[model samples]
Structure formats: structure tokens, C-alpha cells
Target: MTTIKDVAKKAGVSVATVSRFLNDSGYVSLEAAKAVTSAVEELKYESNPVARSLNTKKSNLVGLILPDITNPFFPELARAVEDVGLTYGYTVVLCNSDEDPEKEKNYIETLKKKYIAGFIVTSNQLDAPHYANAKVPIVALDRTINEKIPIVSSNNAGAIMGTNALLERGCRNILFLRGPEKLNPANDRYEGFLEAIRNSDAHYQVVTCPFHFADSQKIVENVLKDHPQIDGIFASSDVSAAGALKAAGIVGKHVPDELQIVGFDGVAMGEMLSPGLTTVAQDVYKMGAIAARVLIKRIENKEIEQNFYEVPVKLVIRGTTREGME
Candidate 1:
């Protein structure tokens, strides 16, 4: 409830100086900054963000726009991004686009009008020039937007190594259950699957799903019924992998003997599932951290490089793809 005027009186400085110091702009000399800090402690003056936003045209917030918040992968990434943003003294505003380009456009405009400090855009939609004039720094996550915008994502091409690991274990006839090409992650992973299949003598093909759990389940159930010869699967997500496993059971097929599965995104469900799905774990934590750091750097004018960052990926071979498999 203490006012800036009160702090100024105690510190023997003008209220404008206190306001500028609190907003992290309008540099103050070392001695004056020290006095302002001391006075802030003595009076406990809390600056109201609402008033500051009106004056400085900023909300002191970083917008985190994701394609699907319901997906375990994105929420995990969001948590990491929030943590990183907190470290840099910014609050994160979460928005779910649900893979809708229109909704994403609206959210971008809304956040732009709100004057968020920056943006961490993680979308499944293609980049649009509508946001080219968007103020503040924007760092894309998990996919590229435009050549002008920077993207930080996992080494999607490296999934071939994981798929090859499964093939090396004597599993041929691998099935790739992926989402639509509209999603860049799915496209990159599908290309990686192709690379692995082409390099090995193993046979593989892809099946497209709607990228939702219910649709993936229903579609995979039909696929399993038709192709009873499938021995292994590389799913674009943990959800699809789970769907595949559930369908295999309903069809009375035991996993790894009749069917082996490897999922993407080491979501909690991956480890908790029966047979514990083998998956390639995207370094989501590092992705989030790097996105946050880079966005902040650009905001502070310290970011020298404008390029794509490909984070590392690791194959988590679990109970699903065990030793002694066919």
C-alpha cells in the first residue's frame, strides 16, 4: 500500500527515478540506485503493474503460445519455459491454439495488443506474414515459422537412429503412425523414419492419423485389424503409441512378440504404460531453457546469432522393446 512518493521522500530522490529503476530502464547512477534500493526496503514500496503498463506500454509478461495444451509433451515444455522465464524476471501468459491457424492468429494479435514483453511460439500451423509486424522478440519452439524468425527444436532427423535401434533388434516390418503433414514435427519425424527404413533391409510404411487420441485410437484399431503382420511401430506421439498398444491387446496380440512399439516425447505415460514404451526423448527442458534465454537476449539486444537451434534427442529403450525380441 506504500506509495512511490513515500519512498522518494525517504530516499531523497524523485518519484520518476524510482519508477524508472523499478521498470529496469532509465539508468540510475550506482550511488542513486543503492539509495533507491535502500529506500525501497525501508518503505516496502510495491509498484502496481497495471499503472506501469499504462505508462510504459508493456505488461512484463512473456507469451507462451502452444498448439495443444492437453498434450503431455507441450505442458512439460510449458513448465520448463515458465521456469526459465521466471529466472529472467518475466511472467508467462499461456495460450492454447489447438492447431487452429485462425485461433493462433487471434491469440498473436491479442498478445501483441497486450504488449507482452516477448513471445515463445510453438505452433503446428504454417507461418503467416500477418505477424511480421508483431512488436517484441519472438522465438519459435519445436518448429520453424519463417526464415526471419529463429526456431529451437529437437534434432528431428536424429529419430532415424532410434528407429534403426529398433530394426537392429531384429524387428522388421515397422509401421509409422504419424499425424498430418501440417504439423512440422510429424513431418520431420516421418522423414527420419524413411531414412532409417531406406538404410536398413527392414520394411516400413507410414499411416496418417488425426493427431488426436480418440481418432488415433480408432484409426489404429482398424489398421491393426487389416495388417496383422506388423511387427513394430514408430508413433509420432506417446498418445498414438498408447492407442496402438491398447488396440493390439484388444486384438489379442502380445507386444514385442507380435508387435513392438516406440513412442516419441518421453511423456510420463510412456514410463507408466505396461511394457514401458521405448521412445526417443526430446530434450524439451533444454529446448525451453534455450528458447527463454534466447528470447531474453534478443529483448536485451545481446543476441548476436539468428539461427535455428537443434537440441539433442536420446533413445529411451524400455520394456516395450526388450532384449530377445524378434
Candidate 2:
């Protein structure tokens, strides 16, 4: 039960030092090596051959393929996954697809050749047939790719809650900034937003974006040019919401007054915005941890019944929207 991290802590040495002592993979000072050996003996630490064998037959690495590293959300998710993988003595290889399908496919092929233990993919494309025949386990993060692969994501209820928040703030006219239709989470958010406003008196419109700030900014600017009556906006992601904010500012519309906005993805940078973006925050860390745990279990050939896991979300109220705007 005692891990190398535990040995490292007790020995007052780094985990890398302990790992080197354990595997003789690299050079270590005699004092550090002695400390690690003493600590391992004291703790009765046992190496997990079974766990090592899971990835060792090919490689002791887990591949984490993401759409964009520039997106803060994905990086945070990747960090959590890497942390989990390291705790289990596996190296995490990060591959950014940059939202390119061909690039994603190429990375998949490359990592496959490397014999990665498993994959935690945040796919940009809707259909990824390359992973269909992946010999190792695969888990989708934040979106559904292959139907056979399990997916771990945040709850789509944030959209409904966000829409209601805007409506509660006296926003009668709202705009929903949706993301790519191929993403399951994006579609869920769009559907949830529509469902919330269906029976309400709030007038709403939908604008799809590529989930990029520039594109979303342009879309909002054009939408505002034509429909100045738009008082509220609910964006599918924080970056898009930032674009909406920029457009509102360009038109001299004050947040929480003339125009209120709510964005999905409770990214850390949201708090840095001028008014601190109001958002529906997903537990990115939790999503990553759950995905890593599930994928590792699958890699170990453990029996798992549930294939879909949805982490809960919260409505993070900030200065962007009013509880009941006057």
C-alpha cells in the first residue's frame, strides 16, 4: 500500500530520488540513496509489479491527447490527470492536437506505436475511428468521441442554471453562444439553455462559435449590431464569454446593468476579468481525476459497469449578472 511518494516523504528526499533508488534508472547521491533504502525498509514499501506490468509490456506511459493546450481548462484537466498517473508510477505524455483531426490521428498513431498504457483524450473531432481499434484502454474527457469508449464530463445542468440566473436578473432578451455541434457537452449545454428558456417570456437567440475568443467576439459584435435588445448572454465556455464581454464593452454596455453575461467553464482566469465573469464552473480537477482513475482501472482489466461519468457543476455568480437587475 505504501507508494514511492510515501517513501520519498519519509526519507526527506524527492520522489524522483526515491524512484531512481528503486529502479536504478538514474544516478543518486549515496546519502539520498541510503535514506530512500532505509525509508523503504522502515515502511515495508513494496513495488507493484502488476501495476508496472500493465504499462511495461509496452511502455510505462499514459497518453493524454487534448485539443488545445492554450485553453486553460484543458491544461488544468491535464495537470490533474498527470498527477494521478504519476502517483501510480506512470509517466504522462501530453499531445496537443490544436483542434486538427489529422494531427490528432497522427498523435494517436505515434503514441500507439510507443505502446502507451492507455489514453485520456479530449477530442476535437466528433468521430475518431483511429481509437476504435486501440489495443489499450481509452477514456474520453469532457466530450464523447467513440460510443464504445467511456466518457467523463461535467454535468450539462449548468446551462439551465445559468439561463435561469440571467432571467432572474431581469434579462428578457438573451443570447446563447454555443460551441461546435460535434461536441456532446456543447450540444448538452445548448439543449439545456433552450429547455430553460422554452416556457419563459425571455426572448432568446442562438449563435454557434468555434469556441475561440476571436470568433465569439466577432459573432457577439455582429449580433449586437443587429439586435441591440440583447440584454443577457450565456456562453458555452469562459473564453467565448470573454468575447461577449468585449463586445458589450465595445458598445459601452455596462455589465450587470445594460448587459449581463454568464459563461461556462469556471476557469481560473475568469476571476481576472474586469467584472469577474459569472460562470457555470465545472470541476475540471475532479473530471481529470475520475477519468484517470477509471482509465487506469480499465487498463488493469477491472470490471466496470458504468461507462459514462458526469461530474457536477456549480453556478459561480460574479459581477457580470445581477440577482435582480434594476
28-59, model 1: which lDDT tens digit per residue? 77777888899989877777887888778777
Please provide TM-scores, in order, for all candidate models, with all chains considered together: 0.89, 0.81
lDDT of 2 by residue, 1-326 (tens): 89878999999999888866776667999999889889989999987765545434556688888877888888888889989988887788989887787887888788777677899988856666777776679998877766778999889867899999998888999999989887788999998998999969889999888778888988999999899899999999999999999998887888878999999999998999999999999999999998998888888778777999989999999989876544
lDDT of 2: 0.86
List candidate 1 segments past 4 Å from native.
304-306, 324-326
Per-residue error at 91 for model 1, in Å? 2.0
Predicted structure with the largest lDDT when compared to the true one: 2
Sequence-dependent TM-score of model 2: 0.81
Candidate closest to the true structure, highest TM-score: 1
CA lDDT scores, all candidates in order: 0.81, 0.86
Model 1 C-alpha RMSD vs. true structure (Å) is 2.5
